[model samples]
Target chain A: MDETDRLIINSLQGNFPICDRPYLEVAQQLGISEDELLSRLQTMLDNRTLTRFGPMYDIQKLGGSFSLCAIRVPAERFEEVTEIVNAFPEVAHNYERDHEFNMWYVLATESPEQITHTNQAIEARTGLKVYNMPKIQEFFVGLHFQA
Target chain B: MDELDRKIITATQAGLPLVKKPYAALAEQLGIDSETVKQRLRNMLDKGQIRRIGAVPNHYKLGYMANAMSVWNVPDDKIKELGNQLGALPFVSHCYERPRFLPEWPYNLFAMLHGKSREEVADKVQQVVKLLGEYCVGYELLYSKQILKKTGLRLKAKD
Candidate 1:
């Protein structure tokens, strides 16, 4: 990435303007034309450098529940267990980590009750205990990656 | 929290379109005026329903591929103070206080760190360790090996 690309990513990490000509406003600040700014963002999105560009909604506030759940799967049954856990659509992100609790995933459901239901279904299918580790509190959750 | 709110979310959850007047385009599709769309978005932002409206860069794609979930077992009383300190660290993108699973697991603080390499990440982690010093009883860095499934919130496909 060039200096301009880095600048765009850093500047637009949050607080994107909400107006008829938001891009123009951002462009004015960045010392570029609206078309140039828009095209750069477009290219970044298309190339997967920027995963998303928009409002990040809080699912819990929207009557949904999200939790970080983990499982310890034996090496032999790792793929099988992953498949079983991922069968549920509520599973949003699943990762393989090098730890006793090898498999970690985020469970996102429309309702709070569904989180338990999904856990039950996962345990029933995998025959392994599911550890639901929801956040008790959030001290802070805002950061901008300065590229 | 109404039908219109749901529609607005489902419409803009993925992201706003890349146009000069993106809200106007969204309003046209939702059969609402540009002003209403803008106002509702502002309301959601003010209500904390929407964290922020902006671009989310893929750190991995941006060359900071080595990432680790560095969790710490901190004292309950000092958790908030330590957590705030950890959150303030530039490399620590996300910091939170979670419940401790005694006997088996005992981590209460979680901080996500990203860097260009594992060594870089480890170096940054040492900074956190020194910063937390006596407050942190124990800690572990769980580096993700691979992403099995990484789907962001999908409001429309499920519907």
Candidate 2:
């Protein structure tokens, strides 16, 4: 990534214009052409430097459910269990942490009740206890990382 | 949201197509006009249904390999104030108040910190600790061992 890439990545994390020609507007602000801005963003997305390029929807507001759940996996069966748990389509992201509750993941479902349904399925599949810890309150969600 | 809103969400959920006239492209695909597409997008943004329309960088790939979810056991009443302070930190990606599961789990405050290395993360934690001071009775850094799977939210029938 060059200086221009850094500028784009740092400046466009959260704010993209809501105008008719949003790209053109951003290009003007960044002192670049619309085509250049578009191509650069395309390359970043293609190369996976930027995971995605678009609007971020609040799934919860759309009548969806999200929760952070964890499981304590035996050392020997860690990888095997991860596969089993992640096989579920509702599992959004799964992570292995350095604690007794070693395996943690976020579950995103269509409805709130689906959380319990999926939780039961995952437990039955892995035979490990699933602890669901949903966020009681979200103080902040906006985060920007300057590249 | 109406049927139009739902269609728009499903259409652009994956991402806006990488094209010169992206909204137009969406309009053509959804059988709507470019103006309608843009207007609905604007409405969604205003309604907070859509947080932002932009790029999401890969922080792990961007050299911030060390990301820790710091859970702090702070006083319940003071949680709001301290959470806001922590949320204001640039490196803190997400800050939330979650329920504590007694004997097994006791932390209620969660803050996600990202850094280039464990040392860098630890240093940032020190700053958070100093701010929390005595209110933070206990805390733990759940350093991620691996990313088993990472994907965006999936709506039942659609992606």
Please list the C-alpha lDDT of all candidates, in the order they appear: 0.89, 0.89
- TM-scores vs. true structure, each candidate: 0.96, 0.94
Candidate 1 per-residue lDDT over residues B24-134, each given as its tens digit: 999999999999999999999999989899999988788888889999998999988888889989888888887777778899899999899999998998898899998
Report, in order, each candidate's fnat: 0.89, 0.82
What fraction of the genuine interface contacts, i.e. the true contacts, does candidate 2 reproduce? 0.82
The clash tally of candidate 1 reads 0
**Poorly placed runs, candidate 1 (over 4 Å):** B156-159
Q: On residues A1-147, what C-alpha lDDT tens digit does candidate 2 reach at each position?
A: 999999999999887876667789899999999999999988888889998889898878878789999888999999899889988999999988999889989999878899999999999988988889999888888678888
How many clashes would you count in candidate 2?
A: 0
